[model samples]
Target: MTLLPGVRSATVDTDRLRMHLLAAGPEDGEPLVLLHGNLSTGRFYEHLMPTLGERYRVLAPDMRGFGDTEPKALDATRGLGDWADDTAALLHALGIERAPHLVGWSTGGAAVAAYAKDHPVASLTFLDPVSPYGYGGVRADGTPVTPDVAGSGGGSANPEVVARLAAKDASDESPFSIRNVMRALYWSPTYRLPPEREDVLVAEVLKTLVGDDGYPGDHAPSPHWPGVAPGTRGILNALSPKYCRWADVVDLDPKPPVLWTHGSADLVVADASPLDFGVLGASGAVPGWPGEEAFPAQPMVAQIREVLDAYAAAGGRVTVEMFEGSGHGPHVDAAHRWTEVLLAFLVSA
Candidate 1:
């Protein structure tokens, strides 16, 4: 992948895993850690590294199952614990004595939140993070809809999409193709990255390790309506409400300042996200949906707001910014504004 002018890529061996990282700026600059979301790697943030590196030491790593990192098996039962611990190990190995500013996008949001719960951080920037209650099978109040947390986790992953990813299909031939999926879901529908940049991003996604130990992970047969449940391995299982939940950030002692930013048109983490089972069922995309009362669309945005509100009520400083007309990746679709707001927050924090 082509890194920005100032960015440099390297490998670091920690006790936990050998990690691939993109780093820039002076080694002694204020540390800034950027964590990427699912289906992506540290390369996803390359476009922003140079600008961010101007004043801080920017380190973005490929987490366990993605990019050039060693494909260590992810224990889904730990939720984001493995990633949090991995980050801690990475920082310790680098001798980062000072707490670093953390910026997480999508799934990375949960990872950083998990870290902040037990570790100190200068600040947190959540860019279109997952719901505090986890991804799916959740109600408005952050409770699971089914006893087994069915209709979520590994099974929720689209098989066609998973297969395409496994095949490393980079073409836009089908809607399920990885390239098409990125174009459709990663940013505003009208926004397009330059051809070369898009090529790099798509290649980065194709590097994801796919299987029970990776992307969607494994699944189990469920007695519930969806007929499937999360298995104890893989990325999606880690994201299941059964294992993933970060709402307890409200109770963190000496909480770090938080900046939450999202796109107004984000479909990936919406109250009725198109990928959500409830939304699919409600729209008759999935048969035998059990109706709205039993499986209403998960209120993802509302759940995040509720948790942040509670965090604020409990005396944590919090800021929220919404970018109109953008999609899931505001940093890509609204780079200038996102950068300005992020820098302003980091400066004041």
Candidate 2:
């Protein structure tokens, strides 16, 4: 992958796992950690590292199973705690005594929240994060659709898509191909990544390990219509509602300021996300749907708003910024605006 000038890559062995990372700026500069989401690596942040590196020590690590990190199986039962603790361990190994400002994208947001619960951070910036409650099988009020958290986790992942990823299909012709999936799902249809950048992004995505200990992980059959529950291993199960929950951030003794930036056009984490099976089933995009009553579309954005509102009511500082005409990765789709708002928030925090 083509890294920007001054950007360097390395691998550090932490107590929990060996992590591959991209870093820039002075080591003595104020620490700023950038965390990527599922199926992505530290290379996803290559563009932003240099700009932010001018003032802060920018560090982006490939979380556990992605990129060059050790291929360790994740404990889905711990929710995001495994990732959170791994991040903390990395910081300690790096000798970062002071809390670093944190920036998380998508699943990375869940990791940062998990970290904030037990560790201190300078501030939090969530870029289209997952719902504070979890990914799917939950209502706006954070209630699960089923007792076993069915209709989510590894079973929710499309088998064909997972197969394509595992095969490392770089073809853009098929929708299930890794490159096409990134172009179609990662950004707004109106916005296109340049060929070179797209290549880099696709390469980073292909680096993701796909299996029970990796991408989709494992699942169990359920009596429910969607009929699948989280397994005890892998990234998808780690994000399942049965395990992942970070709403308790409202109860932190010293809550840090939070800056939440999301795209109005984000289909991955929207109120009726097209990527959500419940929504697709309700819309007849997927056959054999059991109807809306049996499995209503998950209100992911509303869940986040509710949790943040609770955090605000509890006397914590919270700010929400919605970027119109942008998709899930606003940091890339609307880079200028996102950087402006983020820089201002970082300064204020």
lDDT of each: 0.92, 0.88
- Residue 320, model 1: lDDT of 100
Model 2 — TM-score against the truth?
0.98
Give candidate 2 misplaced runs (Cα > 4 Å): none
By TM-score, who's the top model here?
Answer: 1
What is the overall TM-score of model 1 with all chains considered together?
0.99
Error of 1 at 226 (Å): 1.2
**Which ten residues in a row are the worst by lDDT in model 1?**
1-10
Per-residue error (Å), model 2, residue 163:
0.7
Cα TM-score per model = 0.99, 0.98
Query: Model 2 residue 323 lDDT?
Result: 94
The clash count for each model shown is 0, 0
Best by lDDT: 1
